[model samples]
Target: MDLTIHQNCPSCGAPIELHEADRLIRCPYCEVKNFMVSRGVLRFVLPDRAPENIERSEMFYAPYLRFKGNIYYCKGKHQKYKVVDTTQQGMNARALPPSLGLRPQAMPVSLVTEEIQGTFLRQTVKAKTLLERAALLTVIDSEKIKAPFYHRAYIGESLSCIYLPLYIKDEILYDAVTNKPLASGGSAENMRKSGSGYHPTWTPHFLATLCPQCGDALTGEHDSLILSCHNCHSSWAEQQGKFHSIDWSCVVSAETSMYYLPFWKIRVRSTAFGLETFADFLRITNQPLVIQEKHTEMDLVFWVPSFKLRPSTFLRMGKNITLRQAKIPDGEPKMVQRMHPVTLQRKEAIQSLKSILAGAALNKKKLLPLLPDLSFQPMSTELIYLPFSDKGHDFVQEQTGISLAKSVLHFGRKL
Candidate 1:
């Protein structure tokens, strides 16, 4: 008979049953929610069909850290040269047995549906060392270009994590899920013996939004970095595991019934490449954008979507819009009707904005040589809910009458 192990709640010391797939659990006695942290490292296996004849086979999971982000390099002084490139790579810090003959490949794994079962190989390599090594490799492989001054390389907006499953049987190494032999001719004695116990080495913190003042549940969009407490009529932005109060406003539309979208209203003082104002940006780029003197001091506001969107689409939308202060009516709308379960954070939105600006500057052939230090001063980060009309699979912006496909907005049937 198969035996199941029951673990006690960390908060209340009450016995609780947990499945392998359970990432989060709540204590019934103490009403405390706990997040499952992996001990050592956890990697996901690729979804593939098992071989028909393989009735019983040994399986194991190997660790590989996947890194994704923008790589930037800068060199020189007066006429500086800079390059920013996006990259995704998988790196294996550990030395694999010669018989395995498997090369690490970057691929997405569905953590929710996929079942990861097998012995997890201990990570012998440190995460920091691996990142530095990968960064160095990227720099070395890049096309050689001459710079007049100092050289500096760095990565921005980066995320890294490990993923797994390699199978072995009869001196042949196979992919755990696919059952495809990766290599043959290795002695079975060369591989490490499977251990009987499985334990997590690291813990993942659960993302939860609660009103700081009233201790009530807060609501926000899936991609929102800001959340609002309806009970206390307060709004806050979450950053670095803390929440700060912020000012918010919504555009009042004529439509009686409407849904609001969240956006990050950002303002920044950029000092780079001899550019200071919006007019300067337009003049340098020679774009046909017109700016009046009265609106010159107006902060550069970026209306970034608080929901998930395709990268290309997100950039396009951000580039087309101009920032201006919205005129509010007598009484503002209640926060309860506008808050959503926000998933994206302020840091991520800022990263996207920076990427967009960099790309635009490069394309315009203006300010491409000088690396600017963009100091973003959060004048006020608001959760502005713009009115949108639901048209089945598309949402039409009430003000601009622009119809956006639901898929592009990542607003599936859940909306």
Candidate 2:
């Protein structure tokens, strides 16, 4: 059964819509608050367990000898299965206008055969590779993982989309001169009342009391969770949930904010060719294969795998620096090295390695047309307030987005 009630907030005596799971309610009218009952009496559905004795296999795509396109299939089920990348885009020459304040000149656009072909292969293989990778990583406690279909006869059945809650504390601004904090709070409220006694941090008035710059009160007519100091003109925002500060210091501000972020982890089986096709492909590609280098102790080679399941934008940049030290032959590092390392074998390695080399020369402005095919669903969100103060004059909000999503989108642009 479900329950609902209209109750007055104990702190502000304002009308509030109460639910079985609600522990506290805020009063917009009186700017007060109240406590709700039945916080522990909420109902919930159980999670499904992971499937047992699941069969896995190797997956791959082989380009045809002629113009017949390609072939896709899976290897036999085995205890171990690996992922490989085949996308490749190598560096090439391009015509550019004169530098050093010279006049612009018109020139014909030329296509680089090798770069284009490699980029095309990378785009084509990505969609299928991601699907295969997701299927392989799906091994988890079946009870917690979610699947669309469900039946008692099924060994593992779970909800497909689960809203996992989290806490995030983002600091917008830290005063350079004074040690005072001159920013708005970006934390959840529920977790704040978990304690008793007159806690100074729990109350908004305490943290928002003084301006970080001028050390003035932030009192205002706005009842919204976020407010700005009339003296500094800096504002902040927050939601009603649990939040905590991990570490507070002059360098960084850490706080906890509650939120629901989504993700899907799955496993799958795939196959690959048992033989090598070309050695040049191996040299330019980052695919996993054993290689012998002088003065090197290890004989084995491996690549890390990664996934951007949702829609995303990928931008590559390439730059040639004439180092003072002699350059090593055939030494091109994969861009995935910019992130945490994971297992990437066979085809996945080749593809990721190729993409990195292709865009190694991309500048901040010219992203070219290959910037699409890279996007993902939102993992988390937070409403943050940045602080700014001008000594004698008013301050203006920075030229970026006031929200996190927009800000990320802006910076995620080319380069």
CA RMSD of each candidate after superposition:
8.7, 28.0
Across 124-230, the per-residue lDDT of candidate 1 in tens digits comes to 55666655765565456443645432223232223323334555567677665556666662632244362322444343334445677898876543324455777
User: In model 2, which regions exceed 4 Å deviation?
Assistant: 1-7, 17-25, 33-245, 248-415
Q: How well is each residue in 42-104 modelled by candidate 2, as lDDT tens digits?
A: 211111121222111111011100010111111111111122211111111011111101100
Per-prediction count of colliding residue pairs? 22, 55
Worst 10 residues of 2 by lDDT: 154-163
Q: lDDT score, residue 396, model 2?
A: 19
Error of 2 at 348 (Å): 28
**Best of the candidates, lDDT:** 1
**Per-prediction TM-score:** 0.60, 0.18
Global lDDT of each model?
0.48, 0.22
